[model samples]
Target chain A: MTDITIDHVTKNFAIDGRSVTAIDDISLKFPSGSFSALIGPSGCGKSTLLRLVADILAPSAGKITIGGTPPDEARRRHEIGFVFQDASLLPWRSVMDNIALPLEIAGGPIGDGPRPETLIRLVGLSGFENAKPAQLSGGMQQRVSIARALVLRPKILLLDEPFGALDEITRQRMNMELLRIWQETGTTAILVTHTIGEAVFMADQVHVLAAHPGRLVTTIDVDLPRPRALAMLQTPAFNHLENAVRAALFGDELKAEPEPAHG
Target chain B: MVGPVVFVVVLLALWKLAVTAFAVPPYIMPPPEAAWTAFLKEADKIGYALFFTLRNAAAGLLVAFVLAIVLAAIFVSSRKVTHAVLPIVIGLRTAPVLAIAPILIMIFGRGIGTAIAVVVIVSFFPIMVNAMKGFSSTRKNALELMHVLGAGWFKTFIKVRLPFALPFIFAGLRSAATSAILSAMLAEWLSGAPGLGTLILDASSYRKTGLLWAAVIVSMIMAYTIYWLTTAVEKRLTAWRN
Candidate 1:
């Protein structure tokens, strides 16, 4: 099923010979084929959590499991696909080549996974297959990265602010495209984001985190129906979910603001 | 194009004028015409010497390039090795090539081997250092992507790291190439090889000032041409950067 479970995971960094806790004993679960979002301000260690799950960085304590296997095992089996904020495509490689990179790394196509050309069309980048990364705009480059992330058809998709660099209009469009792709692939997706609206709109469950020895504050489930549209952004239910996530994120400060204004 | 041509013409005219005005002796400074006449008379000899010198420099540079890349890969793979070996490399680089040429000739014998060794010793440092920087400077995200894909070090190096390091490698190559001919010529002088460096020394010892000046001019042109050619190849390879 490829569900992810983080059992009391923690991450620490050594700065100036002192151990600084980045993620403090946090636990969460992302069920199979479900989309979840982690939202927090900077220093919240949301990115670190993603890295830990991808086995790019190890947890200082506790354990992480994808389906029933450890992250490293899942990773070695080519079951984890990560999309970074910067796209990170090789400048020398064309779009088609960049998307095909993981396949090459895996020692050729793993099973009956989608081909690079199929992914190019899947991400709606049809004619630009031969174009180099530098020749594309930021949004187009991100699309290429998304296509690349999906090329292997990994069971779990980890996105670390993939649309954070784009303009708002483009961000919403990419978000919609991502949701459609996630639904089609049926991957266990976890998105780390800063925007409350994005977290509420794209995720089935939103996990709020607090900084300074980062810890989870709360998890809010969105009741919004799927095949979510741009028009759903103005719906009261979406606004309500967004507010719940905001409250979880800025609960103390938000409560204090009303008293100061009233006084 | 026009600017360089005009500059060269002006430079030649000034050289001709200075020699005529000062009435300098041919040994001290031959007129431009004297050097040109000497080049035409000994064209075959000068051509052969030039060909030999070019071959030695090219061979040495190719060896150095491959060696530098392999060494850089090893250094990048381990910080302990880099820390241990980099100082010795730096020490070698700081030690004067002139000081080492005699020992190299004794070891390698007075042949093209000595010339190639000298060229490698002279041109290796920049390429190796620049290559190390390039290999290390690969983007963190790219490396992470490789990690996520479970690509081993060799595949990562070939597919991602090597291409990323091309511009830096080329930078080092260009720097090495400009000096490559100079080092090869120097080696020829010490080893008594029949290259342009030996030609220059022989012409001067025989008081053939015209031939000496001609050899110097030809060598200067070769150095500039090598630099231009390296840059041209770099442009073609890194065309995606534009």
Candidate 2:
């Protein structure tokens, strides 16, 4: 079990010699093999939180742990996988080479992890193994990045708006693909996104966050069934859950607004 | 290609016209035919001098390329080292090669060593500066990806930084190549080396204006050829950009 635990983690950035709190003290737990989503508006520190979990950035205060180990140790052990907003594939490298990069960095394949070829097939990119990133579309490039992130078979997967740049149809298709991939790997997954529908669709639990001093406002449980399909998106249950998450996300602002009587 | 050929033909025609119309003295502005005749008559001597200059320039340019890449890597590896040494590098670059050539000749004597040293001094700055820029210009997300993968600094540099910097390094090399021949010739003039520059000097002193013009044209051709070669190599290596 490789659960992620964030204990009162806070991040502060010094801008122009003034301390700005990006993330207020926030605590959350992602159970082993569970899918979670962090949904909030811009400046909500969701990406920062993901970075903190991946050990790419250290928390200014508090601590983050994976399973029973610190994030850095987990990272050093090659237990963390992160996907950025951009694909970030090396332009000169082919799809196979880019996916195999982590394995090469680890000195070799780690404990029988999937081969680059296997990952190419897994990501539905079998014939284009030798294709350069430039030749591929944005969606295909993101697919390569996803394969790269999973190449090592990491225990925790952290995605910071990995599909934020795609069109709506592509985004929805990718969301379904990601869900399928998440279930197959059973890795503790956390997605940071600003889209409410995506958060509700992919996550078992939606953690709503507020900005200014980014802090968690609420966590809404999605009792949606496993092996979810596109048809479920139109169901009353999914709509109810979406509304619940939306309320948690904007409840304070809604309350602060003056009431309208005639309407 | 056709356009450049036409342009060159028109230029030659204008040169011939100017010499005939102005009745320019041969010592000051030799006719095109006289220069061509002189090139044919002294082909062996001029070819030998051209070969000597090119060899020295190639050697110096190679040394400068390796040194620039190594120094750029060192500078990028540590902020403290970069801050401490970059100012010194810039100061050295600011010193005129002509001013340093005499000192170099005094130290290395009138030999190939002085010629090569002069070439290196005149040609290394652009490559070094561009290499530094290339190494630093790697995307932030790419570096973060490397860190997340647990790649050490050396591995990251080899796998990420070096490849990313190739285009910029080639840009530096293209500029450097254009100057390599010119600096080698300048060195030959100071050191009394058997090179195109010395040949031009001897021809001018004897009032062989046609031979002098021929040597100048050959040197220009050599410089353009080197620049074209660098561009070709850059295109081949950086084909992924397309």
Candidate 3:
């Protein structure tokens, strides 16, 4: 129910006694209820940007305001949820307990919002409420991770390559599942991934980022229809959208840069 | 399991036959039959002594468990405390328990307290080291997830880190279980207390080879029982890790 404003945010890291820019000065606004994706290659700091927005890392310059508050404040309000590339579930807890963790942290009444059992069913893990994380497959574990993240009913969902470890089929299935959850919950999701198709298929706008100094190259708006399906991947408009994102990622200046010298 | 039992039976039979064939003196080594007779004859006394040792060992283990958990919490909360204390803990672990037992015996005065203290000293190190390792084994990203969820330290520990450490903690307990009994027996022997260790010491002093062998065998059986119980508990509690 809230928009995110990234106003001139930049992040720098001190690596080996040298200041390296992980994210260059960048600015963007995500409208309320929008599904956006940040697509870039490795080392592009898209994940870093998401982490900053999640308040896990602070920006070196400028500010990021979610809804009307800062990232940290929003986090305290239980308005921000983050999912990592790894499932990261505690191995000893059952699927139900893992999903119940955020609510427990908030020190509220049990299963008060979107109930653990309901979220489990939404993630297609209804039968696995008692299963441990280790017993689930990689894709299934990620579903549990998703359920856990959504348990708090945060206004914003931040995913950093959440399905990057899964195979193509599973990843696509998860993308569809995510889109369904987003539509159902109406939570603004900002996914950071390297895959262009996933970006085009799931996002209302794809924020293409360049490498090295990780800055925004362009933002592509996807004009695909509502309730996107696996079959839409074969449509001309979907291919066009994918190609446009790819061009933004690897076009023009990429062709002009010379190759590095061999060691 | 049956195979091992059969092997033990065969080995004991071979021992009996070897002693008979060699016409070995009873003082040097008793036959298996004589050892068995001695075991039955002194069963009541040995059983009472064994129960005493087990109780003291259990008390020592309980003390060590609580101490290790508290120390692990301190170590996780502050690196400065860990750095200041861990070296000393490790050094103390390396100091021989035998060397300290006499001092403890003098202070505690030939009682269960002395044996329990020795058991705690011998078993403390493994639990502390393993629990420290387990607590520190939390994933970096998992911690960040906690940050995003706005979970405080207590919530994070209860919901994430503590459960993550259960397997490693159980590993420490398994090793500690054996040392608990061993150290207790040693303390009992040295202090001339009422335990299987004292029984063995008395039999040896009186040149009762049969009773000595029986006492040693009983101690082995107790150790095996402790090992099996620990493994069973570990399996039941941590079946998810399987």
Candidate 4:
């Protein structure tokens, strides 16, 4: 497990000869072994921040370090794993091969981590080892991707709306699956999501971001009990945290519009 | 198999009926029975010609297959190379191979090698174009996944791009298989060689209507067989797609 520190990082993209800042001078620290979620409206740079930490994009200013090492170095050392919105498994490869991809890329003797077969079972895909990605349903495909991401046993895992495409029931099931996997692995996880409930339920801390030169508006620490059960969602405490995150987003939206309520 | 055989038999029966019903002149259109008789009488000669032409077609397709793969690789490696070479290929592909055949015969003289060359020229482009499209059509996220895995360019091409391109390549091969025989026969016709194309020409010149019809039918059967064979190969290789 490793801590990720973002020190005043900013990202700007040039379009039509005009500069647009996606993430604007945001700073935060994700201590080792913490589960943090960045949630806000679309275009609030949640995905961009996760991408920066994954070393997929470079910061225009400031720095991001993983366990006191640069993001690039951590990525090169295979300490960072990422899951995109889509499962993105190669359709030709079977479930086992897809999960084994990271190990194949690493190209060495089996490291001291969970094996690919073990991960297939971990993701609840034990019987379909030889089945191609096309044969599996969307949720099953996402599980394969999750197993693939964890195959390298990365120190930190980053997810960008990994379950956004699933139905609500499947999404909740995957959420529980992810929580169990996280607990078992003890790996630091950073998720970029648009769902307030998901962030509150899944994260140790939630960072609410605001759009239009995206910046972090606030960080809410989830004071929920550890080894959270599904029943916790029905509790008053979970509802309160969910309401607080929703209110922050609603307030940001209202502040941008500058309109009064008629009713 | 039974369906094609039945359809062909019915078509042949209709042709026989037409010839007998209309009392058509043998010179204009020989009766189906006359062609069948000719095929039986010259069975040894016809079989040799069939083997020779089929060999030419197979050899030409093999050469074209290799050339297409190499050129497709080059084309995929750099846009500059594709830009420089593709216009000429498109030009060659669009212009009739028949027009180029006479000039090639004039330059290289009448030989089996010249015929093979013409077949190669006629059949290589489709494979190149299709294979190029296939190799380039690798999913963007697949490439990004490779990048995240720290996979090198060669590994990405072999493991991802190549497999993705197989179905397309097979599609190209099916088309090329049909064209291979046609180009070989055309080459033989221009070069005055000993294959079925030359047999057709000789029969026409000698006014042997039965022999001419028989040779044409033989050529049709060869084309059909090659098409079927290619389809079978494609099915076996890409069973996963089903």
| Order of models, best lDDT first | 1, 2, 3, 4
Cα shift from native, residue A22, model 1 (Å): 0.6
Mark the regions of model 3 whose C-alpha exceeds 4 Å error after superposition.
Answer: A14-19, A109-112, A229-236, A253-263, B106-109
| Candidate ordering by TM-score (highest first) | 1, 2, 3, 4
Docking class of 3: medium
DockQ of every predicted complex: 0.88, 0.88, 0.59, 0.39
| Fraction of true A-B contacts recovered by candidate 2 | 0.93
Lowest lDDT 10-mer window, candidate 4 chain A? A102-111
Off by over 4 Å in 1: A257-263
- Summarize candidate 3's per-residue lDDT along B1-242 as a digit string, tens digits: 99979988998989989899999999989999888999999999889888888888898888998889779978998999999998988887788877877788888888878887888788987887788888899888888989898988887787777777878888998899887888888888778789888888899999999899998888888887888898998898778777
Q: Given the true complex, what DockQ would model 1 score? A: 0.88
Candidate 4 — which pairs collide?
none
Looking at model 4, how many pairs of residues clash?
0
* Per-residue lDDT of model 3, residues A125-214, tens digit only: 878999988889999999999999998888999999999999999999999999999999898899999998999999999999998999
lDDT of candidate 4 over B1-242, digit per residue (tens): 89998999999999999999999999989999999999999878888888879898999899999999889978998999889998988887787767887777778778778777888888898888899999999887788777766677788888888888889998898899898888888888778788888888888999988988898899898998898988888787667676
Model 2's CAPRI class?
Answer: high
Docking class of 4: acceptable
Clashing pairs in 3: none
lDDT of 1 by residue, B13-98 (tens): 99999999999888899999999999999999999999999999999999889989998999999999989998998897788877
What local distance difference test score does each model get? 0.93, 0.92, 0.89, 0.88
Model 2, runs deviating above 4 Å: A255-263
TM-score of chain B of 1: 0.96
Give the i-RMS of model 1 in Å: 0.8
